[model samples]
Target: MRGTGKADVFVMLAHPVGHAKSPGIFNEIFEQKGLDSLMVPLSCRPEDFDTFWAGITAAENIRGVIISVPYKVPVYHKCAAAHDRAARVQSANSVRRQADGTWYADNFDGVGFIDGLKAGGHRIAGRRILQVGAGGAGASLTYC
Candidate 1:
C-alpha cells in the first residue's frame, strides 16, 4: 500500500527522451506488482545534466534512476559503486540509491537482450556469438 503523501520515485533520465518507453513500462510493472513506486521521465540536456542530477539525488524519496543515451557514461562515473560489467564497459544504464545514500550502478541492457533471446527459444550456451557495432549497446552485449 502506498501513502498518499509521497512514494518511492524511480526516474528515467534522457537527453532526447521523447522516444523513451521506460516510464510507461515501469509504471505498468509497479501497478501490476502492487508496489508503491512511480517511474517518471526527466529530460535533461548535456549542459543541464549535473544540476539536474544533483537536485534529483538530493531527494530522499528518490529510489533509483535509469540512464539513457549520453548520460549513461556520466552516470556510471557518478555512482559510488559499480558492477564489474559496467566498469569493464565504462557504461551504466541503471543506478540504485543505497540505504547509506550511495549510488550503485549496473548495466542490464545486455541481460535484457539475452533474456529476450532465451524467451524466444534461442540457445546461447557454448555458442559462438558475433556482434557488430562498437557503440554502447554493442559494448554491453559483448561484455555480457
Candidate 2:
C-alpha cells in the first residue's frame, strides 16, 4: 500500500533502527486514519550519516522524518527552520519537509511527556513534577 502512489513518506532515522517502535506505531495510526502515508525505519553507520541525510533531503516524496538518539542535534542543525523548543536546546526529534523541500525542526520529547501526564488526568498547573537525566532529551524537558 505504501509504494503504490504519491504517499507521503516518513523516515525514522537512528543508528541501529532494529529497535525502533515509531515506524510501527505511526504506520498503525496511519492505517486507522486511512492516511496515504508510510513511516519507514532506517539506519546507517555514524560515518554514513551525512551522505544518508543528503540523499534523504533530496527525496521529494519524503514528507517528514523522526530522528532519534545521536542524530537529533545534527538534524536540527541542518533544518532551515525550527520551533523555539528545538532552537533553545539545539536538538530536534522530528522534522517535516517544507514546501520548498527544506526541513523544519521541532522537538516533542517534553511536550509528549506533559501531554501524556495531562491525558492521564495529572494536574500540571497546580502541581510539581520531578525530572532526572541529562543531554538532549533532558535539556528539552527542562526547557518545557
Candidate 3:
C-alpha cells in the first residue's frame, strides 16, 4: 500500500513546481523499495513563503524536503544546522528533520554536478567550466 496515514512523508518544494521531476523519481524509488513513504510536490508564491514554511515545519510526519529554485537560499536560512556544502553556498537543495524537529540543510548541487559529469565520462579537472546562472543553484556550483 502506498501513502497510508502512517507513511513517512517527504516534500519537493518550489515556487512553480509544475515541471519538477524529483517527486515522481523519488516516489518510484519508494515503490520499488517497498517503503511506506510518499513524496509530495508543493508550490507557493514568494509572498506566502513564511506562512507556507511555518505550516510545513509543523507537520511532524514530514521526514524531509527537497527544495529547489527560489526556495533554496531561503530554506537554508530556516535550517537549525547545515552541512558545509550548504553553509558555503548558503543554499539548500535538501533538508531533513532532526530529532528536535528542526531542519538540517545540505546542498548537493555541486557534488551532483561533478558526479554526473564523471558518470558521463567527462572530466572537470583541466577544463575551464563556465556556469551561466547566478541563482541559488548557481551559488553551489560557483563555490563548490
Candidate 4:
C-alpha cells in the first residue's frame, strides 16, 4: 500500500527488510534539517507488489520507492527501461515510476558498499576483497 503526501517521503519496505537502517538515518536527517519528510516502511509480501503498486500509482504524494530483495528482480521486468548496470545485472535496488508511466531502475549497492568502506577508513583502492559467492548479489561487486 502507498501513502499520500500527507507525509513527506514514502519508502516501500520489502520482506525480510527489518535489517534496514535507512529509516533511522533518513529520519534523523529529516529531523535535523527540519524537513517535513518522514520515512515510513511499507511492509509488503513478495506476491503483493503488483497489487500494492496499483494503488501507489494512483496516489499523488509518493516521491519514490526503495526496493529490496525479490522485488528488485521483478521490478526490472516491470520498468520501461533500467539503468545500464541494472540492465546488465538484470536486477535493481531502486526504482522510480514517473508521472508519464515510465519506470527507471538503478543499482546503488555497489557504490554504497565501496563508499561505506572508504568512509570507514579502509584502503581498498589497490587491495583485494574476497567474495565467496559470485552469484546474484555479487554481480556488481565481481568487477569491482
Candidate 5:
C-alpha cells in the first residue's frame, strides 16, 4: 500500500491508460527534496474517481493529490475548496489536504507555462499568447 510508510503526495493522471512523463518528472523532484513522497500514475477512467479517491484518501500519510485530464472537472466539483486561480479557471491540477481534513484545489499550469516562457526570456507582462488546446491542459493556460 503506497510502497511503504507515508507518501507526502499522491499524483493522479487521467489519461485513460497511456504512457506518462509526470512520474519521472515529479519523482526526481521528490528525490531531490528528500521527501517521503511518490507520484504514481493511476490508470483511471472518468467514472472511477469517487472510488479511487476514497481508497487513496483513506490511506495513511497521503498529504495531497494531483488531478489530471478528464478527472480535473470532476475533482473540482468534489473539492472542499479551491484557490483563487482554480476558482477563476474552474479547473485544477493539484489538490492539497488541509489540516482540518478539507481538500483544496489549485491550478499551477498557467503559472508554470508563464514561468517556462519567462525562463526562455519571453516578456509576458503584456504579451499575446496563442495557446492550443480546449481540454484540461488548455484550461490550465486560460489565465495567460
Candidate 6:
C-alpha cells in the first residue's frame, strides 16, 4: 500500500484476483522510476463489473487498469477505442484513461509471452507453437 492521496492509481481488475502478481511487479517498477503511482488489485466479479468500472472511471486519481479473464471481452466493448490486436482477438488485457476521460483498450499478453521467450533465448520463427486452452489468453496468443 504505497499509495498516497496524490498518487496516480492503476488497478488490476480481475475475478479471483488473489493469484495476481501485477501489483507487486508494477509497484516495483514505479518505485524504481520514482513515479508517484500505485497499482492495486481489485477483485471484481462478473456481475459487479459494470458498477466497478463506473466507480473507477469517476475516480480522478484512477489513471488506468489492467483487465483480466472474464472481463476482457466485456471491457473491450466498453472502451472508446481498441488496438487492432485487441479488436481482432476481441479481448483486452489493459486499458488506459484518455485525456477526455474515455478508456482505450489493448492486448499485450501475447507480445509479453513472446518477449519473455525471446529473452530466454527462444526463437519463434519457423517454430510450431502449440498452446492449450481457447480462452481469452489463448485467443490473444493465437491472434498474435
Worst 10 residues of 6 by lDDT: 1-10
The number of the candidate with the highest lDDT is 3
Task: Judge candidate 4 against the unseen true structure and give its global Cα lDDT, from 0 to 1.
Answer: 0.70
> Compared with the true structure, what per-residue lDDT tens digits does model 5 show for residues 70-100?
7777777767899887887778888888887
- TM value for model 1: 0.87
TM-score-wise, the better of 3 and 4 is 3
The CA lDDT of each predicted structure is 0.85, 0.89, 0.93, 0.70, 0.74, 0.87
By lDDT: ranked, best first: 3, 2, 6, 1, 5, 4
Question: What is the descending TM-score order?
Answer: 3, 6, 2, 1, 5, 4
TM accuracy, model 6: 0.91
Task: Supply candidate 4's per-residue lDDT for 88.
Answer: 82
Candidate 5 residue pairs that clash: none
- TM-score of each predicted structure versus truth: 0.87, 0.89, 0.96, 0.75, 0.81, 0.91
Candidate 6 lDDT at 77 equals: 83
Query: Clash number for model 4?
Result: 0
How far in Å is the alpha carbon of 36 misplaced in model 1?
A: 2.0
Lowest lDDT 10-mer window, candidate 4? 1-10
- Which pairs clash inside model 4? none
Give the lDDT of residue 78 in candidate 1. Answer: 85
Candidate 1: misplaced stretches above 4 Å? 1-3, 125-130
> Which residue pairs collide in model 6, if any?
none
Task: Provide the lDDT at 9 for model 2.
Answer: 92
